[model samples]
Target: MPRRPSGINDLDLAIYGHIAEGGELTLSEISRLSGRSKGVIFRHLRKLSALGVIEVREVGGVLLASPSRSPRRVIAMGIMRAAEYPYVLGILRGLRDIYGPVRVLVYEDAWREAQDLLSGRIQLAMVPALTALVANRLGGGRVQIIGGGSGGGMGVVRGTGGSGHAVVRTSNTELCAERLGLDGPRSYFGGPGDILGALVSGKVHEGVLWEPYLSMASASGLRVEQCEIEHCCLLSANSGVADQYGKISRIAAAAISSARSADLQAYAKLVDLPVQLVESSVRGYSFHEAPDVAYLERMLDAARRALLPGSSVRDAVVA
Candidate 1:
C-alpha cells in the first residue's frame, strides 16, 4: 500500500505561525497540539519547507523551524501637514506588509532631522522636496533620491481685512514669495496645515497651503485666497546604503499606486484614520519615481544662485 499525500488544506498554518512567532517546535509537539498523526505533521512540515515559508533545523536529532529574515526598519517624516501624512502612512503600511515589522518616525520640522538622518545617523528619511534638494546638495552623494510625490502648486491665503492678523508661511516660503514678489509682514508656521488652520480661524491674514487643504478651506465658508507655488515630497536614503535605494523606491511607488486603487467608499476602512481625511489625502496628490539626475542638478544650480549669501549650506552632488 502507498502512503497518502497531504491535502492543500492540511498545510497546517498553525505550525508555520508558531515558527513565525520565534518558537521552534518538533513534529511530535505539533501533532499533539493539532491532534494530527506524527506522519501528517511531518508531511506538512516538509511541504512548508518546500514552499520556502520556513527553515528546518536539526538539533540533537530533533527538527526545528525558524523564520527566514528579520523585519525591516523604516522612518517617515513630514506628517505635521495633514495632506502629507496620508501618503507617508500609506508607504509605511505597504512596506510593513512587504518587509514586515516596519517602524516609523514622524517629525513636524523634517528639514533639519532629514539632513541628520541622511548623514547615516538614521536609516530612513521622508522629507519635503525642498529639504530633499538641500540634503542632496549638502550631503555630497551621501543622500540618494529614491522616490517623491507628484509635483503640485502651493497657495497663499489671506484674511480679507484685519489689524495685527498674522501671515503664516513655511520656512522655505521665502523662495516662493520671492518668485511671486510678495512683500508684507509674515510669520512662519511649522507646516502647511498649521498655516491653513490659522487662516481659517482668522488668526492669520494669509498663509501658504497645498491643494486639498486649499480646497477644504474654501469649502469651510472662510474667505480664502490662493496663489500657485511648487510643492513635492521625497523618499531618500543615505549614500552608503544606495544598494537599497531601488528596493525602497519600488516599495514607495507601489504604495502610492495601491492607495490610488483603493475604493473611495472603503477609505474609511483604513486603520486609525477617518474617511474624510483619507479622501482629502488621496485627492489631487500623485507619486513619482526617482527624479532624473539632470533635473536635480538644475534645481541644485538654481538653489545655489537663488538662496541668499551663506543661506545654502552646500552644493548637491552631480552625476
Candidate 2:
C-alpha cells in the first residue's frame, strides 16, 4: 500500500497546491484563489517557511517563493585533492539536506585566479583568509564573508638536530610565521602535494602544514615539531549580495551542525580515511548562527592582525 504524507494539514495542502503550478503568486492572488484573507494566507506562508517547505526570496522590496531552492556554489582550493576533498564532500553532503544542490569550483592556490573568479568573473569563491584580505584590499566588495572551517591546526616541522635547515611552510603559514616572530623563508610552496614532496625529498628540513600532511610527514620518519599557531577557514562572497551570502552561510552552518550531531561512530568513520590527518579537520569545524554586522567586523579585525608585519595568531568563525 502507498503511504500518506505526514504532518501536513489542510492549509498546508492548499498552499502547496496553489504553488504547485511552479509559478510565483502574490498573497492577493493566493487569497483570491482560496477565498481567504490576505493576512491568513501570509500567516500560512510563514508557517511553510518555518517548516523549510519553501524559500523566501526578496526582490526589490517584494518577497517571492520560487518552486526551486536557491542555487549555491563554493570556490575552494584543493577541492579535488585527496587530503581535503573528502571532508569537503562530507560537509557538502550535510549541506544538501538543508540547502538543496551545491557546486564547487576548484583552484590550486592561484590568488590571482581567485580574484578573477570573484570579480563577477565567476559565481563563487573559496580562498584562504589571507587571500580574501588581498581581495578586500583590491575592492573585492562583491565578495562577502559567509562561513568557513578550521582548515586544520598548523605547526612548523623542524629537523632532529634542532638547527634551522631549509624551512618550509604552507601557503597560509605566513600567519604562523608572524605568530612565532619568524620572517618566512625566501622560498615557499603552496599546495599540500608540493609541500609533502619537498619534505619527503629532504629538500626542506622544517615546514608548516595542516593535517593528513602533517601525519603523513610524521609517519614517513620525519621528526615533526609543533609550532604554536591556530589555523582558520573563511567563506566570502560579493559584498552587495547579502541575501545570497545569508543563504549560503545558513546552509554551511546547518551542515556543520548536522556533522556535529552525528554519532561518534560516524565521526570516527569520517576521520579514519586512508590519509593521516588531524581529527579537527573533520570534526572541529563549527559555524555562527546569528551572524551580522558585528561578526563581520570582528573577522576583519582578526584577519588584519594575522596579516600584520610579524604576527602569527589569527581568529576565525566556522560560518
Candidate 3:
C-alpha cells in the first residue's frame, strides 16, 4: 500500500480528492462539493494547505486550490533578470534558510559564474562539474568544489532509435559520453539549448541536452538517452570565502538536494519556463553532494581525453 503523507486526516484526504479530480477549486466550489458551509470549508482549506497536502494560490482575487508537493512556505526569490541556472532559486532558498538574508548573485551563463569566481566578484557559483574543475585550475587553485549540486540531468539525443547517418553535436554532456561509449560524428554547439534547437529542427540527427531542454526535446519528439554521469553540476567556492565555505556549502547541499516539484512552481515566473515543463523537469535532476571518487575520476578522465582547456582536474579538486 502507498504510504499516506503524515499529518493528514481522513477529512483532509477527502478534501484533497475533490481538488485533485476537478484540477482546482475555489472555497465555494469545495464547499459545494463537500456539502459544507463556506466558512467551514475555508477553515479546512487552510488546514490542508498548512499540512502540505494541497497548494493554494490567488488569481484575480479568487483563491484556487490544487494538488501539490509538500512545499515549504513560498518565498519570493528575487532572481536577477539575467539569471539562467534552473536551480538558482533553490540555492538562494538554501542560503536564506540557513544564514537568513544572505546575498546570492545569479547569472545567465556558467562561464560568467566562472569569471566572477575567478575575479573574486562572487565567492560561490553553481556550475557543471567539469566547468568547476576547469575553472578551479584556471584560477590557479583559487576555487574549490565546496559542495555538490546535482547529477544525471544531461543526455545524448538521437532520432529513429540511433540508426542512420548520425550527425551528433555536442555540449558539456560530452564530459561523460566517451566513457559511456557514446560516440559519433560529432560537432560542437554553444550550449544545450542550441544543440536542442538544432536537433529538433532536423539540422542535426543527434545532440546533447540538459533539462528542461531535455524535457522539451522529448516533448518535441526527440529521443533522449540519459548518460550515466554522476558529476553533472557542482558548487564551487572561491578562496575569498573559504572560512565559512563549509557551513554554507552544507546548507546549500542539503537544500538543493531536497529541491522538489514545488520549487518549480515557486520559481516558474522567475525562470520564464512553463510551470508544467519546469515541474515535470524535476525528475531529470538528482540533487546531492559531490560525485563519488570513481565517478569524479571518470569525468576528469573524459575531460582530459577531450582536450578541454583546463589544468589538471585531479589537482583542482584538492582531495
State which candidate has the highest TM-score.
Answer: 3
Better of 2 and 3 by lDDT: 3
Candidate 3: regions farther than 4 A off: 1-90, 94-109, 159-171, 180-185, 308-319
Top lDDT model: 3
lDDT of 2 by residue, 1-319 (tens): 0111244355654675576445687666777888889788778777666555565566776667644363233222223222332334455444434333333445445365346546655444444556655666676365555675444445565534322222223235555544554433333565555766766666665566655566676777776655532324455566644655666666556554454444434333433444324343433233333334454454454455445533233323344
What's the lDDT for candidate 3?
A: 0.61
Worst 10 residues of 2 by lDDT: 73-82
Q: Which of the predicted structures, 1 or 2, would earn the higher TM-score when compared with the native?
A: 1
lDDT of each: 0.54, 0.50, 0.61
Candidate 3 TM-score to native: 0.60
In Å, residue 5's CA in model 2 sits off its true spot by: 18
239 in model 3: Cα distance from truth in Å?
Answer: 1.6
The candidate, 1 or 3, that scores higher on TM-score is: 3
Against the true structure, what is each candidate's TM-score?
0.58, 0.53, 0.60
- Give lDDT tens digits, candidate 3, residues 72-130: 32221122221124556656645544323233444434566677777876666666677
Order by TM-score, highest first: 3, 1, 2
lDDT at position 223, candidate 2:
69
Estimate the lDDT of model 1: 0.54
